[model samples]
Target chain A: MALHYSPVLWNRQKRLYDLTMAGLMALYLIIFCTLQTSLFPPITTETIVIRATSTLAFLMLHVILVIGPLCRLDNRFLPLLYNRRHLGVSMFIVAAVHSVFSVLQFHTRGDVDPLVSLFTSERQYGSFGQFPFQPLGFFALLILFVMAATSHDFWLKNLSPRVWKTLHMSVYLAYALIVMHVALGILQQETSPVYAGLMGVGVLTVSGLHVMAAFIGNRRELHPNAPATDGFVAVCDVNDIADNRAKTLMVNGQNIALFKYDGKLSAVSNLCRHQNGPLGEGKIIDGCITCPWHGYQYLPENGQSPPPFTEKIETYAVRCVGTTVWVNPQPYPPGTPQTPALLKVTTINDEN
Target chain B: MTPPLRRAHRFIWLLLVVALPLGFLATRPTKQSPWLQEPVLPPQSTAMPVLLRTIDADSLVLNLRQSVRGTERQLEILLKQPFETPSAVVCIRQEGSRRAVGLLNAPGLYRFPLPTGTNRPLVEIVDDVHGRTVKTVQL
Candidate 1:
């Protein structure tokens, strides 16, 4: 969205989002610390900070993991996805504080270095019940640190979207590591079943939402059952698509988004140039296809962003024979201008 | 997301759905280890001897004896066999403060002068190499 990279591209929404996030984090900390002190009078301040920050970080991670699926299930959650990088970075900072405090409390005051002591402190690698869990936490924190470091759009541009996305996908691995870190670490010592039950619920909710979202997304994908004639695949009727909206079609291994607007039909690759968002889910705003995930706009005819922007997507040759819209599965190069298929006046009048 | 990424996501979640609960259930404490369980304070009788065993399978045992000598109480660690862990050391924790007493690698008696006003001190055998407490006995 930015032509030049600044430290951050802050807008009114981003400012409000950050302020709300900070306020909620501060409030959670106050409530957690107050309750922890009242319930466990013998607990030390160091332990309280460690527990509070760790729990907060873990909760934030669950929220981050669910936002994508939530947004997929309902577009109303897109706002949460917009500023998610800030939440991720904040979670990493909290996790780092927890890690540092834990090391200082448990690993310091020893003859060996704190890092070395952390690994050597517990020699129960062979025992499942007594395995050393700190190293797992350390590795998970390392992954989060990498993700937080590369969260900027600058990295996204330099690394290319595919590489960047693949790197960020490792968040799932990090989440898995964190789950085991909690399961094998403090859960072993804590006698309360409430902690275990809460953890189990968190795991189930995160996984369940992802599975549901994937199922919905799969159902939305349209695959042509009939073979193509002369490289043109009959996708759907012109009336099947609403004005300014698109219907996604899969033909000849190509994912296409066929858009109907002003009695004209155009087909373009469903994959948005930015973040590979499903362009078919977006609407034509101001005569341009606006990506639902991020408002990255592209001209429907040329599959190119408007002036002052350089992003583009592959366009397909499309035509309407009597009201049945057919699209050539072979795609033109990105930004290739294609003639839109105009609907017949009688057909438009009949539908009206 | 691409089809491959979606497939990977589904596979990962499926694995987690099965693995997470299993891992958590496996972590449940079937029987509490002696070192992890609540410490039972021994009676303040000099005649009664307290015995502690290492957490590992080595079965290394140490007898703790408390005796009064010249108006001062002394705690002695009598090891029946040499410690299997060469870096093990005997430590005393009293009133939230811990101090190493002596090495337990030798199969002999080691004595440490117990400070006056020490109450219900916990005796521990720590493996310095691993930086873990291997045994604990409360007195």
Candidate 2:
């Protein structure tokens, strides 16, 4: 987070990510064109580039979508989440190349205006098999342009994280449009079942991954280790938690993670502010509870990230009696400093 | 980045690189290549007489008649639908030889040169969009 806007905050990791992405994009175009020319002679240059870029951008989008849920399911996929915006912008660039070349190839020399032709080329909207798909692609590209233009953190800060997230979610809408664009446009003319089968595989892969991730998250939320008590929920025994680790508890419909760190116990909201990452799954590093996804951290005592970064989460009151730990269902505001629950001297030996 | 995450990033790049060749192989075209097909004549019946009738909304008309210049034939094709640049080709095939005669976007009479000693030549028109056959006339 920054008070003032800069084009980008480039770090070593971001540089490497962008460079690799660009190189892969270039390599894809080169290889695609080479194979097209070699396998199918007489293919025009414009057609080759247009198809290559469209397929490349489509493939990149699928990868981007896969990374999100994959990262949520496993922390090992976190690096893809770091420079995801860069990949998004690159996809947009490739998509734009496809859109331009398509217009030039299909609409340019027609009697009507190019834009008009794009809309009116296939006038049979009444028939689903022959629907005018260029409009769908055009609108999807517009949404992608909006998303790419505002991918920077500057927009995230000004628009608020919630709004930015909501806006970005329109990517799913664009994805739907792209699916229809291909289904009604290219798939209509393409007789080979291979292309259709590939498209189906892509759709199913993305949908299946997201559904699996959501199911796993929901199962974790539905069942918690904490037993129901009067007002406070009895979490795991004080000895059950390892140093710098947490025992996740569900209290009053809220997931609260009770952390044991530096011989003290603290409870904070399990949900990370960014992307709703699971905080309980993360461990304390450098005195801060680091989120397994994207590495966003929050102080254990107060659910606030370190100074200069304004991200925060709700903190809960907790206490340890003998060897057992209990947490109050009530939660304090973000950044509220709740006193750390003291561990009993007798319970110290119980920690393994 | 953590070691595991860094490894994942590298894996994604590798997958992307590998996906290119794999995608091409998976989508290998199976349709008969136009180049590989024998230069066979289009469907034939009787030669069409000359006419100046208006073209249909969705069809381009090909008027084939004996050329005034010689025993050669001429084709007066009119495109009722919008087409790309004036690069459409009128292909004529007789026996084994196939000749592609270029035509402009504007309606005009094009010299339909056929192989010598050929009486009836099969004609096919290929447009810029998709290389689809816009019109075919057997003459």
Candidate 3:
């Protein structure tokens, strides 16, 4: 993915994505400020900036968390997953703004340093309702800063995907810390049920989506069929896949999407290169599998996007006998074109 | 973007644009709210019979108190302790007249005699160093 270690690739898609992200962020801030001023008149500039940046960062974090399981549920969501690191970095910047402003507002001009005062402002560690929440947020911000700084492929390559992914997984811990920070900090002070309810909804939506995706994945894996013979496996009957759609199967420890398109059957790796989106959940459009998340398309025969688009996925050989479709689970090199297995006349006749 | 994802993006934007304003409106502080309102002054005490309020002018503490005698409640004013300055003026407002009562730097309490039948007169503690009323209290 990296030709050289030059900052970013700066492709059209990435540029467009970043532009959209920036627009949304601006919109959110504008709305937040307008409402805050309109309702609570004579608001201080520091308070406005602190609330606006913190809320924007919180919303961005929710979006980032949802993208992962969303990609799992449908490959069409992969486009959002493609450049999610940018969102993370943006979130960290906004959060940093909030952090700096908070320290200046509440902790400065004291006997202690700003950072030191943040922790020492209140000594209610044993009390949950009166806990000193700034420390929790401070630690969470530190984790986000680390993740954002090391989000580039340079770190990914050096750390390896497993290590990189594991490190990034600390986002869950950060999220939990932030939740507690809000719970003990503003929620305790504001005592507004609306704020509490919104936070509850956000937590539920994120957790619910992840649980649902995991459940679906586990259910599919529990299926005892699709036993491999030699290097190939009988995935399903041709009719099991609807026209222009795909049936996902797990074979040889690899997830595969068997597509039935234009009276031909083809197999490709289920994971989309962009975000590991479920390719099988996508539908064929214009003879190319169009992912549901961001509309990234790949031709089934070659597991490659049409020329001018360099994205590709691993392809597999497929065959049909009667109504049964057999797929060679061994994946070919990405973009390798293979002849499609046609549905036999008897299979069509039997269906008719 | 496909129809569904496009719809979702629009929905999210709409929610934030609409819901955020509503949230702010809902949680808006009232004029009477403690955080937004000016802090309440401590209640005047009846147990002491004569309320004494301290006015801090730089490092100096000017104690202003009131006393009831016969038919008149006199305004008593003094520096909590002795000061380096020998002479200072304390102003008392009574019967629509402003009178300057001189105070000595000699330490003990100084009482300001007012016209009989006057009740709860306003006493102003002038700054000994600056020659201006630094604090005002009704006694």
Candidate 4:
């Protein structure tokens, strides 16, 4: 379409550009997986692909979480800010392969239906030699299934962001359970402590970083969430919005993610339509606030996603006076056009 | 979190992570009874309360497949009940070591060969499937 000669154009579209590159990463994965199976015979082809892809997907999603915020922490990192949604969708596909392969591997192994073994496998529950940890992994995989299925924008519109976001939050627990599953079941049974140790380190490091960032950054609720005074109210200091990425406000008792972008800010429902990652935690990538768990992006101005992705969020108007910031509590539909008041940096001449 | 402080906490955290599994390993309970460590159940544990009291040095070497048959059950034989197996020579022990040689005889006895008259130590038939002592024949 059109470029804003304003150097700001780079920041605006860099996310899209970053996303385009991220898409290539998936293609690379597809190629890498294809070549690996071709080179190794005797190793079941589907098993290898599912295993590689599932592992890669899990890793990539974690990277998306880490990278999205890091990119926002610094403007120069904007170039690295890319379409994270593709990364998310692609990871899901690989995870789907892993899930499918696992099911097939566990359910069928010849004429003797293996389904009989899953429950009675003895390894399925705690026994003298068996560890009671299979159900945890099973449950995590099921959670991933739901998160992936409802990742599209259509589901966000139908289910409502509040419900969708809450469901998505379960990913954290799923991840935690997966760790336990590996520890008690796979690591305990398999003699390879090194492999188990490495995997544990990988997951723990990524999770640790997120927790670290959350604590290091603003942990204070600057403005105690004001009871809905009037229809809606400003939730946090304009300085707070500019200082930290976002804050939750009870507007009409509904929590929304107040967004800050390009010296201008907008308030929208905090829940991400894709996987329910925190919209507030998402960085201003490509001039859009993205979901932290899965890279779902929405324009702060109008809540509609950048083209090709149809996700949207409820929109609200944010006004700033001197240093104070106020938010109109009323939320419009995601696709509705919003003419939010833009901030005009102070002019030397206007200064009394 | 400064890098050093963060690292310290992490180091401790990692140490803790390391400590847990090691702790688990240290506290892990295992079936360490030598006599009751074989594939076939060693004669019931002498330590475990058992009714049938029999002490004999009946040792033989034989192929297990052709000897004992039917389900192997952990029976607490009463002192008054008849205690017998398909093979009269059910098990053999090394002279000293509690390690026992368990010969499952489905129907045939002495179906295999052994180092006749030589007892190295002890022979305790340990049920490897479940750490249970089935028969303990002492010389």
Candidate 5:
């Protein structure tokens, strides 16, 4: 497929996004450096961690909002699209930190249960003027957790993608709740409007991007299918399939890839189970073929992930005849898998 | 994945979540200083005029603040003793040649640093807590 995507501008934009996140965090701390000693946290390790984690969480929400529509604006953004699960997971991590640190600072005393104490505090569940509970903030965090858990391909496979997408979209509602929570809970207590304004800006930016996606993205055209393969007929020259890297092949009425890496070469399903990202387009690292879109790595031999990760994909058989390679497209028994038959790479171009 | 590895991953995340807050609540501190160490004692002679708390006799230390005034000094010692005088000039010292180390404020804390040795007979302290007492001692 000779599709011209991955525009130079889009790559530049990605680099810019990465740098901007780093710069924003630096600026955030620099602005507060003078007040750190005077603040409630007052130069403690825990306080630093709390501030850092909260700042990171806010950054992630903005990234989520921006990246979605940006991909729609250009084809290159599609790669960013494929790995959004990892991004969501990363966001959950920071949010978890912020929540924990907050509970520790506010609710813990002697032997009291921290979770119980959060609700029990008079400052939380009070009257309207003092309506505590931090219900808005907590609600937001709970939604984040739900989204993170369901961000995996397993969930996409188990739960229909449409439902999964809708459920995960509740993050936007969670985002709104978080804004109110922060504004009322923290900014109100401090009598400062600066934080409130910043939060509003973050929410607006994200919401704006989604609105743009809705306008431009054609739901019917997304994920168009490819012409199915005929029989087990290999495409790429054997020489082009690098050691541990993948080269796309049309074989035995299916699109598969040949992977040679980590002292092993094998054939397997070409479509990324997560988002149908081309498995062949990804490179191999540390014995695992990492999806270039989101860096989800899989073992090439049997497509099993390293222990504890449990991600796996179907495998296929392959053979080499003189200068060319061949693959049998029938998928193998999954679950507990072994390397597909390996064919010795006999260099044809060496003599010619 | 085997059940154990799957469980390990699940538990690690749980620990991460739990440890984040629980850790913050669980960590506190303490206070110990060098000033509490006892200072060395001078030779044990009557000339030093030191009173003894009878509970501990073999091992001792002294750190007396030196600021004495008046030709007739008052010695208030929290120790076992024989009343040796009334309204008289006194020279108190180790059980030896006459020399005095008068006591202006004697009721001070005495810490028993170490257990007594059997080689020396025990020192005894006798005192009445609730009593109208007039202490006039000659050394």
Candidate 6:
């Protein structure tokens, strides 16, 4: 919800989020280092740093990945989704530290360049046991660098939400690479089953949550099977929608958000202009349909953000006939004003 | 998220559900334990014994042997005592270039096939944790 882009539009919530993240990261490092030093007396400082940061980054990545599906499954996790970029950036920094120390420790001693040695050190590509796992990690780090670098809204705006989202989706590839990196690298040396078991649980949890969320999302999609009358599809009764909230409907290949607010009904594109967040999941706050993901707002009548904000979404023609809300699936141009279909006072009373 | 992205997400996880477990199963270590085998010196080997000391002043007996079969030269090393430091490696340095022979995990006989036509090779036992050469021997 910014008019102009700066380095970071920090607010009280963002500041609190960052502070909490930093504190938790530091606490994790302290606990991990303490346990490592006490358990393994012969471990070096570099090894400890490498292990601690790598584990922290991996754990943070798991948390970051799960946050998305968790939000989709339950709105209670939306707060975590709001500040996820910070978590991603922090994870990248920690992962970069791990990559730096690993290269310094393992590859710097060689006569050839560190990067060259990292790729060419073990040329057992044909063999699964000796596959070059470090390169996978390096490429994963590269993807993370790109994601962390373009995490700001400025890039999101310039690149467009679709491209930005597609680029950020590479995090899944990075996660896969990291999984293989660990499976083929450290898991080979470490005899303990605990490490492998924990990794298995992480993979299962991430994949499982995503699958469940997708299933729930598919089930929740409102498909209008009722026949259309005069190009207007009867989506639901006016009282079916909660006040100030919306019910998303798919009519004539259009995803529409039918919002009921102030005894009136307005229909707009379900997709928010900002990051394509689900507008239907959001509620009208102060007469603006606020996006649930990042609080990007749009006026219910015209699908345009309030003054000073240029963002807009497509507005659909909606009308109420005998308490049944009918919406024209064809969308008007973004920011085009449409008269909201007024619900009967009796309908409002029935909702109450 | 858009419908396409949702489909892609589901597809990616579906693939991962199959691929990850397969990868984990495929990469499981299949090689035999090196420690289980008895330490046996190679036959027809010329042993060049050398005394090496660690930074902690512990003496180590390193028996380096070169067994030449036709044009191939193999370097065989037999350590009398176990290397106490974890992640230690035996490296061969020839003309300013160093190459790790193998991990020196336990005191035993180890064989590494050497590159042909090398002069004045130096063998060093390095502590990988500290990144220091603990002991060195010229051959």
The TM-scores, one per candidate, come to: 0.79, 0.71, 0.65, 0.52, 0.40, 0.78
Task: Residues A136-253, candidate 2: write the lDDT tens digits.
Answer: 8999999999999988877776786567766887787788778778776776667678887898788777766766665564555424445555556666678888899887765566
- Tell me candidate 2's interface RMSD: 11.4
RMSD of 4: 11.9
CAPRI quality band, candidate 6: acceptable
lDDT of 5 by residue, B1-139 (tens): 1122223433433443343223222211111121232242322222223333223222222322111331221222333333332221112333333232332223333322221221122222212222222332322
User: Which candidate has the top score in lDDT?
Assistant: 6
**B-chain TM-score for every candidate:** 0.49, 0.43, 0.40, 0.29, 0.23, 0.51
- Which one is best on DockQ? 1
TM-score sort, best first: 1, 6, 2, 3, 4, 5
Candidate lDDT scores, in order, read 0.81, 0.73, 0.72, 0.54, 0.52, 0.83
> Highest TM-score, which number?
1
Docking class of 4: incorrect
Q: Taking the candidates in order, what DockQ does each have?
A: 0.31, 0.06, 0.04, 0.05, 0.01, 0.28
Question: What stretches of model 5 exceed 4 Å from their correct place?
Answer: A1-41, A123-129, A218-352, B1-139
Model 1: lDDT of residue A168:
91
Comparison by DockQ, 3 against 4, better one? 4
In angstroms, the error of model 5 at A7 is: 30
Clashing pairs in 1: none
True contacts kept of each: 0.41, 0.00, 0.00, 0.00, 0.00, 0.39
- Model 6, A221-248: lDDT tens digits are 7888888767778888888899999998
**Mind giving the per-residue lDDT tens digits that candidate 5 earns over A224-258?**
13332333344445676667677665444455657
**Predicted complex 4: DockQ:** 0.05
Q: Per-residue error at A53 for model 3, in Å? A: 1.0
Q: What share of the true interface contacts does candidate 4 keep?
A: 0.00
Better of 1 and 2 by lDDT: 1
